[model samples]
Target chain A: MSSKAFKQPWTLRTASSVFVIAWLILAAFPFLWTLWGSFKVELDFFSKADWRNALTGARTMAEHGSSFTGNGYSGAWVQEEFWRAVFNTAIVCFFTVAISLTIGTLGGYALSRSSYRYTFWLLITALIFRAMPPITLVAGYLLPFFEWNLWGILPTTIVVLVAINQPFTLWMLHSFFQKIPKELDESAKVDGCTQFQAFRHVIIPVMWPGVITTGLFSFLLAYNDFAVTSMLLEKENQTMVPKIASFLGTTQTEGNVMFAVAAVVSATAPLFILVMFFQRQIVSGLTQGAVKG
Target chain B: MKHKTFFWFILPTALAMLLFIALPIVSVITQSLFTPHEQVFKTVENCTPFKCTQSTTIDQEATEALREAQPLGRFVGLSIYLDRGHLAFGEVAQAWQSRDGFGDFFNKIGNLPFYRAMAFTLSYTFVVTPLLIILGFMIAVAVNSLHRHLKGLVIFFSLLPMIVSPLIGSLVLFWMVDSRGVLGTGLQWLLSNPDLSLKASTGLTWIMLMVYGVWHSAPFAFVVFYAGLQTLPKDTLESAMIDGATRWQQIRYVVIPHLMPLVTFVALIQLMDNFRVFEPIVGFNAEAHAQSLSWFIFNDLGGETRLLSSASASSVLTILGVAILLSPVLIRTWRDFNSKG
Candidate 1:
């Protein structure tokens, strides 16, 4: 791909480099700044006198006797009991991913293998479902959930999230399954294996790459969700994102905004690691739908 | 596959979507038409002395019984949709009759809660979608031009904003742009307006949200466009260059035509997403200045007295808006599928 014709003149190269650098800063700076500010005292973080105080942790020095402090982390984790939300988040993400992938794999594989006209309709239905904002559905859930005593529980929220995630998970996995050769499964079936057995034995082994990618996305949908979790979960059963939101209500007046900041950083850490490890998969997953279009 | 086998295979997901996604839309529509029962009132007369006063009191038992009997409340038809909190048909008529001009009529309409949210949602969707596409294309081209070793690092950093939860991403930016925070102070210093506050003005708040929207979604466009660029026909590009076309001209003619489908794809997805922009309003604490339709519904549902009817009406409207926005794509998909089949 690298050819002599592709070579850029100095001015264009400089401009491109400059633009990329500027974009990189815009992309990465806020997270970096917030991570730095999370260690500082509130006064220093939202310093009224000078913004540089945040960089230097001037108030943090006066208050905690250090430029770097774990006070916010401790306050959020121990004092605010943010670890409970973390635990709940772990449970929700794990279960949502597991269940979504289980059902999504079956449905997606069936859609890909079948030649029926219904398959197209089902995929289109999923697309329409995907586009409906989850919040609109939340309004529907509240009444029924309250009546059935299904409100404010972790399991209910997990199921709701899995349901909300199905449209996307099905779409992604269906595209992926479509890419695999039909002969792989058809050959296995000719040996007299039942459909489920064929999928279980032959298709399952090779399906991991696609499953893992879909699972990553399911985990993200559950993890990054605010609307469904916030509305559905009980206060005690609240996940990290909603827990952070709840902090704004209670902690703002107490001058403990740093607790929220610390919690935000803590919640983001796993995603950071996920992206670091699964960069290729994440990129491919995002482009999968577009490529199909 | 046999129909029975297909049914068995698809049953679980089908049930989930039907029960949760499909039924909810029905529930929302039903709920939208129904208003919660007004508190049952009883006028009780108490005679003590010469002059006695009679006061009307809410009949707790009756109201409780009423609510218990019919959990969905009394059906109000489309009244909720036409109320002041929603379409405000009456108010629009009044405004139209009294308006000096279109601007004045629009000003009145803008004051309505539903219209206000619609205005912001539409503006944000239209403004952010194109800007993000252009910014994303530029970034993709730039990153594609970079040395191979640096490409991974640039791509990793670029994906950060999009990958982070919209709420957290916006909160991070919101903190920075707080009047006392870094960017806020930087802007003040640049403009030489010590009193300038981004949050305090409507125009600035709208711009801030749109900027955050673009920042958050651009990486998605970049990644898709980048992938499209990988499959670009190098021979065509070479031929264009050989024909005395400038680099820009080659991109204009060759590169863009190849990526046109991807651009449509990105724009369609972005339109659907940006229309439902709710998290940033909460994250930025910008609800006071800007309210999106989703935010409007969230506000109704989250309050102490959940305005179920109001929220449901808004949900129905929002769903209709989505259907309208997605009709073109749906029709196109249907056409393509029919042709292929």
Candidate 2:
């Protein structure tokens, strides 16, 4: 243990605070703004004059009365369309993560354990799939679904969205699962554990951090997936992002302050919760999974 | 016993990948060549002809001599690369390469927006990647000098950008810069001016978006560097320090050379990732800015264009670009793996 920096507490604290605050603001300001924007009224946002209306003061709140509620700070917080977007986004996120992880982990495990002649090729192919742009996949395959009349499968766009994300999930999760030593599996099996049981009891616990990291990433990737979702889903199936984006585009015509309010309401707290809880695992996962790979 | 279980274990992964990831991509490229959507082209054959010629006709009149002429060439096969007059495909495949089944496909890709997208994407990747590595290196060195626990905390903080959904994260930034948001509002008041918008301007927006991309991306770099820093050999660093080397000098000599392998890996992955900068750019463009290749590809999917072929062609181009750019990295990693084995 190299315990060296204890003598210079004040200097270290100041430096760390400066780095942390600046980085946090730059990294998180957009999400914070979304939180605040979701509560604003039409009048405040209308002229683009009140775009700077900070929610810190009571005067702004009083002036923007109908938009601000006690619980949500926005009176019209419970719109059906807003909830529908949230629901739709949740559905997409759910399926995307579920399907991707199951395949990713299984594939990652096989690659890690088996000394196949083409293992490297499989790994590299997975990396390429992960690396290729999502737009390319969506663009290339949008027609196949249309041709199959699978365009009706929640829009041709969603199908593309689901497909594009699969490769990423596979590669990231596979790499994470690979990091656990196989000796643990071998030893567990020798001690009367079957292969599946060894995986369940021995390998899984060790890889939990990786799983969390990968799952969180996949979830974020799916949730934050805007391009494919926006392109694929129509007005009814549009996820939260496109709904918010569409509203932002039509704010003048719609005269709805609550959409921005809705953007804030739907995303802010859940995202913050994810960050606050999974911060450590997510960081390790990123460094190990992406940067060092 | 060994053979049966091994097959079982490997079967699912191989089959899934073959079915899902590999097959679709391979099919996209091949399908583009053979099948032109009936809606978009009359036939893949008549997309553009090799040459043009003038013709004249005279009515069959008594006691009048008439002459007529037309292009005196036979219909060529899809091979024999004829010049398709599109700037997107450029002239590399136009002159001599196109006399095969791949000629029309090459010429078609030559004329599409795919090439411009590739140029734009490659430029974006090239510009942003070095900037990330350099900045991340600086931050990693600065953080490394701090106490261990505190250093870990700082590194984690920097990495939050990686954790958040880019859709939510990037879009939030987009709103924050909007005239009505916090930064926008603060700026407007500070300037005390109406019509002084930050994001509305293209030059500023482009720079700002790049900054956002860097900001979101640098954390991964920082973490990798930090991890490399942790595993770095201490004796070498100590030897440099004992020679009365300054901290910067020690780092430049001892730390950086040690970190090169990690550096190469990070750079290659980032290059691949950045060239595919679809989501963030699309998110930015959704709020109205310049278009990116990904956005164009996405938009092209909806129209009467031959999206599958176009997208496949673009994807193939991107994959090739990535492969070419990162060939050194690939070679190095391969060598490292082989040597270790």
Q: Best-fitting candidate, measured by lDDT?
A: 1
TM-score of chain A of each: 0.97, 0.78
C-alpha positional error of residue A232 in candidate 2 after TM-score superposition, expressed in Å = 4.0
lDDT of residue B260 for candidate 1: 96
The true-versus-predicted C-alpha distance at residue B128 of model 2, in Å, is 1.9
What candidate 2 gets wrong by more than 4 Å, as runs, is A1-20, A42-52, A55-80, A152-181, A187-207, A254-258, A290-293, B1-3, B34-116, B143-157, B179-201, B232-235, B286-289, B303-309
Residue range with the least summed lDDT across 10 consecutive positions in model 2 chain B: B63-72
Interface RMSD of 1: 0.9
RMSD of each: 1.2, 9.4
lDDT of 2 at B214: 81
On residues A93-143, what C-alpha lDDT tens digit does candidate 2 reach at each position? 777667656656766676667665566666666666666665555544455
Residue B188, model 2, lDDT: 82
Q: Give the worst 10-residue stretch by lDDT in candidate 2 chain A.
A: A68-77
Worst 10 contiguous positions by lDDT, candidate 1 chain B:
B44-53
Candidate 1 lDDT tens digits, A6-82:
88999999999999999999999999999999999888888879888999998888877889999889999999999
